[model samples]
Target chain A: MATDDAGESLAEVGEFAVIERLVAGRRQPDAVAVGPGDDAAVLRAADGRTVVSTDMLVQDRHFRLDWSTPHQVGRKSIAQNAADVEAMGARATAFVVAFGAPADTSADLALELADGMWHEAGLLGAGIIGGDLVSAPQWVISVTVLGDLDGREPVRRTGARPGDTVAVCGELGRSAAGYALWHNGIERFDGLLGRHLVPEPPYGQGRVAADAGATAMTDVSDGLLADLGHIADGSGVGIGLRTDALSADRDALAEAAAALDVDPMAWVLGGGEDHALVATFPQAPPNGWTPIGRVLDGPPRVLVDDAAWQGNPGWQSFD
Target chain B: MATDDAGESLAEVGEFAVIERLVAGRRQPDAVAVGPGDDAAVLRAADGRTVVSTDMLVQDRHFRLDWSTPHQVGRKSIAQNAADVEAMGARATAFVVAFGAPADTSADLALELADGMWHEAGLLGAGIIGGDLVSAPQWVISVTVLGDLDGREPVRRTGARPGDTVAVCGELGRSAAGYALWHNGIERFDGLLGRHLVPEPPYGQGRVAADAGATAMTDVSDGLLADLGHIADGSGVGIGLRTDALSADRDALAEAAAALDVDPMAWVLGGGEDHALVATFPQAPPNGWTPIGRVLDGPPRVLVDDAAWQGNPGWQSFD
Candidate 1:
């Protein structure tokens, strides 16, 4: 099915032609003052400040091509980076990606990946402004997201104080439970399996939390407790989570946990990659946000129901 | 020499600890409203527009550890991305890096890489805001830079027209010549070899050209003629280089070409990664810019001494 002009491999089509094809016919958002084809892209920051973050996903380490379509990989890459911006109490406006793949990969696959990125970016009303493509032994996608704070002060992890209510605004444990199902080769939970491939981050919720006066915020990239540990350490306060409050999350994954013979609490407490928005508030949380715990006095640790539960803390890059 | 805690590999130190060591006690610029340790960094844009760009460097393909120290690699990464911002007629203000390395790498080496990045960023009064670290089979560094345009209209590649003089600032052919010398194992031209590892882009000259009424501009990341071909194609015009005007650039690389048995003109016309600023001007060129070519009517092509070149055009990622 290979054509003489299109090439059988990326090496055949070459990097420049592939990049040109990837960039062709794509529409940029209004916020983008200057788009791709230049050394850099210029984006308008209406509020005079920009919130920025970056994430890297390596093949086999982050995802297996056999399990995820290139489109799903692209969406996941964009979603995860966008989540970081959301965690900062800002709205993502633009993204610049740097992708590396083997030379023999099909050009069509790369286009599908770009399409997936565009699909996800469209959801946020953001644009893919610029990117660099290169040859590597495997696929490696690195994304950097720029966001606007809308003149509001940033909600940092170091701002949480004792007695602040800890709340969350998205699903948790589904991705980790999906990982378990995928590892065990149990395909019964289709939704959970899909969640592992592409996460559903609650868009526009960061601004909502900021408007509701969030004292501190973060995304659940690492397990809930592990991510909370960062806030505790950064803010120098203890964080205590209530298991009763997370029963809904645990129940959602009870079936998968049973199939894998693991504690559902482990997934609820220690699993990660759900991209859930977690924030602390001095008063009642805004709509769609459910209170899960409270900030405690000094000691700098994340506790489960007032006690330190012993289990796998969270995912480690080396591990 | 291998102490347990002192020289532990990245895997032993873990991602969090390694990051803590990398970011510990580093000073950030005043523009950085938020730095590392948060889910994202917040930077002041001041001018309501942020210029963004991304570049990926792969080990073996982009740089060899044998030829460059981790510090040089870091400097090269930051410098190249900063050149992209400068080309857009903006001042680089901040950067975010996503670095992937094997788990077996030493933590000291990563800290050294960060040290080099900070050193290069300091040249432009910019700060590294945030970054991501993950495990990979080899080293892959991706850098995204954000710049401030200060209310100036962005100089685009599609703005050049017929009757415009093409001018270039900074040296050309030196990086490619240095690469050739290093590839051929000729050590006579140490400065040329160093230039290959870390390009010296003409800093702040892009804004100067833009202020002086240049029509279009781009950085010479690819070879001069090849990069000019982009300007020609984007601007829908032809570019004719006057070889006699490039005598100074040729003379600078003659000794290196003689040492490596390659044509100095080939390096000047077809070498990439020098990152010199090339632009089109309707009138006399700006101070610091030297006239090298002229834009022609109709067809989009780059001519060397008014004739089609018969050599390698430039670099492609896959090739």
Candidate 2:
């Protein structure tokens, strides 16, 4: 159980002992009544409703050990799941993680992973309440986030209507662009590469958007066009984006696009995993959010400059 | 999204379409305010508290496709996670599952897995609220359960005291016995073999134990002795088990043990995954639970008939 041995393999330390080390000295939030050393964790849901979501990151698929440190993978796992909760107009309170890795993996790596998770949870003032560790052929992490809505109605994707303004808060296309940089072995874009590894989701902006009377909300996980298409389809209303409004995002990625000989607008429109909060509002957007589009009275679809722009739409798991 | 084309591989159908098939037509319980479609699901936790737990099952480690159907694996995944909440004296209200598999895996298998999960969740009046699906090299399923404590104190494993009786509700060793029978290719124990595929945890006994004043509680997940040792160590008390108290369990697996030329007591003491509820009580244990041991005022350890039993204690993830 001692944290002194940083080089031991998980098999050498054993499950219970490794668990002891992973759980040692970690501070849990006040909302957690019963923490890790129990059959299940008990968390306060003060407003009578609990918002829940889950996401799994697979080795070589969701992340690469060679490209990412265990810490970054852990952070990405927690951040992505937390983004889902944020999209629901809730503040993430706690997380329960289940991790699987080969037996030969270092216990230190697992500890580092936990440390990264703790760091991310701390940013949101949340706790990693309970987890299960197991042996697998490759590292796989599944994180489930629990969120607090503070008695507000969840901002669902079905609430957008005609005449509503669509806005976004946080960076867009950085993750996809970062992936290109990493994949192409171009190390010059340090900030973009780091953003891809550990995304900075506009955490509390979700509740702000909710309070601002946003009609619908979702996080941009599967590219701007693809994710907004979900909102459009769900709300049975079309969405029209102004290219001029997304010019800043395009400009941000312009240097990288020129370096890669690619279109910067493609990354801005079709890139994913930036975890930016996008919502539709009937009035002027919230202060921190930038209005880039509007809901329209038409069949469900997403248009660029009021026209269907052709390119890669977005990511799909199987693809 | 149509269920008729069950033969297509996940890659051919894509992620969102497969998710639509998985989510369609499932009736959610009243506790679910928003289910499946949204970025996150919302559930009412009437008592201001939520009990949460998670587990991961990897291919050829936790289960096998050749030996168990996708449905069985799904049921096992949900059942095991639900048991953890049950051990905490709460009724599981909803679940969010994250699953990974090869792109070539049939979409039908995924649906069958959801069917199996739904079948098991139905037993507890819970619903599958949300999930993520991704591509991986092999099948990996992670399930997170949410439960309501209904205003009662959560029964933790640190409450046992000297002189308290240890009891168990639900079958013991059946899963291990079934494993041994299947391993040896001696297929006489039909009941045990089926149990190995899908465990039957005593659904409502955790609350019953809590209502009956159980001081310390945990599920028999890592085996009776190993899990009870958790209680013993957490509560700073020793435990003494009476073999006579476990005679019924031994008898149940007697034929299978003989056929495999193994000791029935070993399975009763060391086997796991039966998901039986084990707790320590200050007074007589409630009906439907069999008394198996007593807490001793000494160092933390487990003994059989007042002495340590020399055999395999239980399971470890790395092992």
The numbered model that scores best in TM-score is 2
Worst 10 residues of 1 chain B by lDDT: B1-10
lDDT of 1 by residue, B10-67 (tens): 9888999999988887789899999999999999988999999999999989998889
Ten-residue stretch with the least lDDT total in model 2 chain B? B1-10
| Candidate topping lDDT | 2
Q: lDDT of each model, Cα atoms only?
A: 0.90, 0.93
Model 2: docking quality category: high
Off by more than 4 A, model 1: A1-7, B1-6
Instruction: Provide TM-scores for the models.
Output: 0.97, 0.98
True contacts kept of each: 0.94, 0.96
